[model samples]
Target: MSELLSIAQLSVSFGPVKAVRAIDLQIRRGEAVGIIGESGSGKSVTWLGALALLPGATISGSVMLNGQQILGASAKSLPGIRGKRIAMIVQDAQSALNPVLTVGRQVIEALQLHRGMDLWAAQAEARRLFDLVRIPSAGRRLASYPHELSGGQNQRVMIAMALAGRPDLLIADEPTTALDVTVQAQILDLLRDVQRETEMALVLISHDLGVIAEVCSRAYVMYAGRIVETGPVDQLFAAPRHPYTRSLLEALASLDGPLRRPNSILDGTAGAMVQQQGCAFASRCPNRAGVCSHLEPELSAGPDGWRVACLRADVAGPLEIVA
Candidate 1:
C-alpha cells in the first residue's frame, strides 16, 4: 500500500514543557496501525499536533498527506482537509456531540460540509451512516439528542458522523474508553468492519494493549513522548525487544498460561518530565545503564521492519541490570 500520511520530526511544546518530542510516523493506505502506551506518553498529542488541534501549543513538524504539507499550512486550507480527507473520533462521545443538536443533524452537517449534499440528501445519508455503524433503530435515533442515547449508542453516533465524511484516514483516540467490555468489543468490531469495507487507513490510539491487538495489524509503543518500539503486533507481543515493552506485556494477564506478576514499571504512572538529555524512560527502566542516564538511544531498525530504541535490544526477558 502507498503511504497515506507521514509525520516527520513532530514535536509539540507548551511554554517550557514539551508534551511531544520529535518523532516520526507513517501510515499506509488501508492499513490499521495502533499507538499504545500509558497515559501522558504523547500518543494523542502526535496526531493532535499534526492536525493543528492543539491551541497554544508551539508545534514544530512536517506533516505530509500524499506529498502535500499539512503542518503550518494556511488556516483556510485545514478545514477542507480535516473532515474530508482525514477524520478523528475522540473519547467521550457525549462531550464531542453538541447537546442541542440531534444526532441526525450532526451527521447531516458533516455530510453537507464535506460531501456538499442538500439537507434532504444529507438526512438520508445520515440514516444510512447510522445503519452502517450498526446503531439499532437508526431512523429514530437520528432525531434523538446525544443525552437521550446510551454511551454505546452515542459512540456509534460519533462513528456515524465521522464516516459521513467518507474520510481516507480515520484516527480513533481511545474510542472505547467509557464503555463496558462487551460494548468495547462491539465498537472495535464495528471499526474493523468499517475499515475493511471502506478500505480506509485506521490509527487506533489506546492504552489497552488488548484493544490495539484486536484491531491493529501493526503497533507502536510510546514512552515519554517518543516511540520506544514498533513492529507487527504478533511479533512485538511474542518477543518484545525493549525492556519497557516487555514490562508492559508482562503486566497483562494471560488467559492460557499462569499469570506472571506485574513488574514495578506498572506500579505507578508518571507524566513525561523535562529531559534535557538521556533516555526519557531511564528513571523507571530496570535495564538502565550508566550510558542510559547520559545518552538517549535512537530508534534503530531491527528484523522485519521492527524498530527499537533500547541500547540493549538484544537483551531478552526481564532485565537484571539496574541504574
Candidate 2:
C-alpha cells in the first residue's frame, strides 16, 4: 500500500491561540484511518488545514499527497483537489446541503462539474448514485428537497454527492454522529462496501471510539493539539498506552466496569494551557510523576507500529498518578 497522503509537523493557528500543534499523520491508498479525540482536541482543525478550508488561518509544515506538495498551494488550485480528488463529508448534513436544491439536482450538479456529464446523463448518474446509497424510490426522491428527507436520507445524499467526484481520498467528519443506531450501522456498512468497490482511502474524524473501531484500520488519538497515541484499531483499543486513551476506552466500556461512573468527567482544561517543558496531559493524567510536570515525553514506537507519548508506557493496570 503506497502512501496517498503524508502530513508532517502540521500546525494551525487562529490569532494568538494555537488550535493544532505539530500533528503528523500518514494515510495509504485504500486505507481507512481515524482521528479520535474529545471535543476541541484539534482533530478537525488539522484536517481543515490540510484541506485549505480555513480562511485567514496560518499553517506551517508539509502536506504531501501522492508526492505533490499541498501546504502552500494557491486557493484557485485547491478546489481542483478538494471535491475532485479529496472530498469531505461534514458532520451536519442539513448545514452542508443546500435546502432549496433537490437531492438529485445537487448530485447531478457535482457530477457535471467534476465528471463532465451533460444534464440528462448527469441525472442518470444521480439516480444510480441514489440506488448505490440504498435510497428507495430513487426517481421520486430526486425531486424532493433536503428538508423533506429524514436524517439518514440526507446523510445518504451527502455520501452520494461526495462520490460523484470519484475522489481518491474521502474525509468524513463524524459521518454517523447524527443518525440513529440502526441507521448508523447501515451507513457504516455502506461506506465499507463503497470502499471495497472504489478502493479509496478514507479519513474518518470523530470523538466516538466505537465508530472508529468499527470502520478504521488504524487510529490516532489526539490530545490538546497533538497526537498522543496511534496504532492498529483493535490493538490500541485492547491495550492503550496513553492514560488519555485508556480513560476513553474505560468511558466507552460496559457499565459493569468500575470506571463506568455515569458522571465521570475527565478534566480537559489543562490541555488548553501550553506546557513548554512538561507533558501536556500531566495535570489530568492519572499516572503523572514528578518528572512529568517538568519534562515532555516524545512519541516512541511500541509493538506493532504503535506509538505512545507517555513517559511510562511500560506500566500496566489502573493508574494512581493524578492532580
Candidate 3:
C-alpha cells in the first residue's frame, strides 16, 4: 500500500497557544487509522490544520497528499483537492448540514461540484449514496430538510454527502458523538462497510477506545496535542506501553470484572498552554520520574513496529485492564 497522506512536523498555533504540536503521521491506501485522545488533545486540529481548514491558525510543517503539498496550496487549488480528494464528516451533523436545504440538494450539490455530474445525474447519484448509507425511504427522505430528519438519519445524510465526492481519503471526526449507543454502532458498521467496499482510506478521530478498536487496524494515542503512542490496535489495547495509554485503558469499563476506581489521570485535566521543556503528560503520569519533568521524550520505534514517546517505556508493564 502506497502512502496516500503524509504529515511531518505539523504544528498549529493560535497566537500564544499551540493547539497542535509538531506531530508526524502517515496513512496508506485502503487503511483504517484511528486518532484517539481526550478533548483538546489535537486529534481533530491536526487534520483540520493540514487541510487548511483552520482560519487564523499559524500552521507550520508539511502535509502531502498523493505527492502534492496541501498546506500552502492556493485557494483555487485547495477547493479542487478538498472534497474531491479528501472529505471530512464533522461530529455535529445538524450544524454541518444546512437546515433549510433538502438533504438531496446538499448531496446533489456535492456531486455536481466534485463529481461534475449533471442535475439529473446528480439526483440519481444522490439517491444511490443515500441508499449506500442505508437511509430509509432514500428518495422521499432526500426531499426532507435536515431538521426533519432524526440525528442518525442526518448523520447518514452527511456520510452520503461525503461519499458523493468519491474521495480517496475520508476523515470522520467523532462522527457518532451525538448519536445513541445503538445508532453509534450502526454508523460505525456503515463506515467500516463503506471503506471496505470503496477501498478508501479512513481516519477515525474519537475519544472512544472501543470505537477505535472496532474499526481501526492502527491507532495513535495523543496527549496534550502530541502523539504519545501508536501501534496496531489489538497490540496497543492489550499491552499499552505509555503510562498515559495504560491509564486510558484502565479507565475503560469492563464487563467481566467488578467496577474499578478510575485512575487519577482521569481526574487531572490538561494544563494551560505554556512552553513545555518536558513530557506534556508528566504532570499526570503516575510513572513520571524526575527526568520526565525536564526532558521531553522522543517517539522511538519498539518491537513489532510499535512507537512510544515515554521516558519510562522500557520499565512499563503490560496493562491489566481489559476492554
Compared with the true structure, all predictions reach lDDT values of 0.88, 0.87, 0.91
lDDT of 3 by residue, 32-80 (tens): 9999998999999998999999999999999999898998999989878
- Candidate 1 has a TM-score of 0.96
The number of clashing residue pairs in each candidate reads: 0, 1, 0
Of candidate 3, the 10-residue stretch with the lowest lDDT total is 258-267
lDDT of 1 by residue, 209-275 (tens): 9998889999999998888999999999888899888888777766774665645445445535465
lDDT of 1: 0.88
Q: Between prediction 1 and prediction 3, which has the larger TM-score?
A: 3
Query: After superposing candidate 1, which stretches have Cα over 4 Å from the reference?
Result: 262-271, 318-323
Model 2 TM-score? Answer: 0.93
Candidate 3 ranges beyond 4 A from true positions: 257-267, 321-323
User: Which is the better candidate, 1 or 2, if ranked by TM-score?
Assistant: 1
Clashing pairs in 1: none
